[model samples]
Target: MKKTFFSFLTFFIFSFSAFAQNSVADEIKTLSKNKWQWMADKDVDKLDKLFDEQAMFVHMGGSWGKTREIEIIKSGFIHYKKADIHEVFSPIIIDNTVILLNRITLLAVVGTNEVSNPFMVTEVYVKVNNEWKMGSLSFSKLMGLN
Candidate 1:
């Protein structure tokens, strides 16, 4: 009786933990997709809420902080016209931090021209006051094999 009870309890605990992790990953994935949509729409208010105050953004050209990123988005300096997400890998969760990887083709307007490129975007989110806020976003251009 004791052995059986112990085994059951252990299984239950492990199952619950796995479920929690999966839920957190799903939530972050949804948030990430929403963020891309918001950027394409140039919804600064929504982006502001999603981005942490100390957030950092890294692009192929350069890197900047949250305020400057917001300004750039608002000013249409680097407009995110669209994000065609090819795949979103499972998130890596460590305590209150989650890192999501996405393979996408980004369509953007820079200066007077619009261009599209394949990239692997890494998004880092930190849990603050029970809310997930994006702490960093880095885009790496993928080289064409052909």
Candidate 2:
């Protein structure tokens, strides 16, 4: 009787933990999607609110910080009219925090030079203070995209 009770107790705990993990993962995905939408709409205020103070953005060309990224948005260089997030894989949550490896394909027009670039992007998100934030980003132009 004791062995069966212990086995059931372990199974119950495992099931609850799995359910909680899935719930957190789904919340992270929704939060990430909202951030991308904010970026597409050029909502700098929201963007600023979405990033941690020490967040780092690494472009294919180089790197940028929170202030610089917001400045670039304010500069009106890239207008992201349409964005399609292809995949977010292997999202991990540890000790009330979540991390995701995301890949997105995007189309944007450069307002300054009248140039359009279609690109593939990789992003990472981390949950801080119960809010998911963009922790890092990198992008490369899609080849044969003219």
List TM-scores for all candidates, in order: 0.97, 0.80
lDDT of prediction 2: 0.73
Candidate 2 segments exceeding 4 Å error: 111-120, 140-146
Which lDDT tens digits does candidate 2 get at residues 1-146?
99999999999999999998998888777877887787778899999988778878776557889898888776767666566766677567777556666655666666554444556555566667767777776676777754
- Global local distance difference test of model 1: 0.96
What pairs collide in candidate 1?
none
RMSD of candidates 1 onward, in order: 1.1, 2.7
The candidate that wins on TM-score is 1
Off by over 4 Å in 1: none
lDDT of 1 by residue, 94-142 (tens): 9999999999999999877899999999999999999999999999999
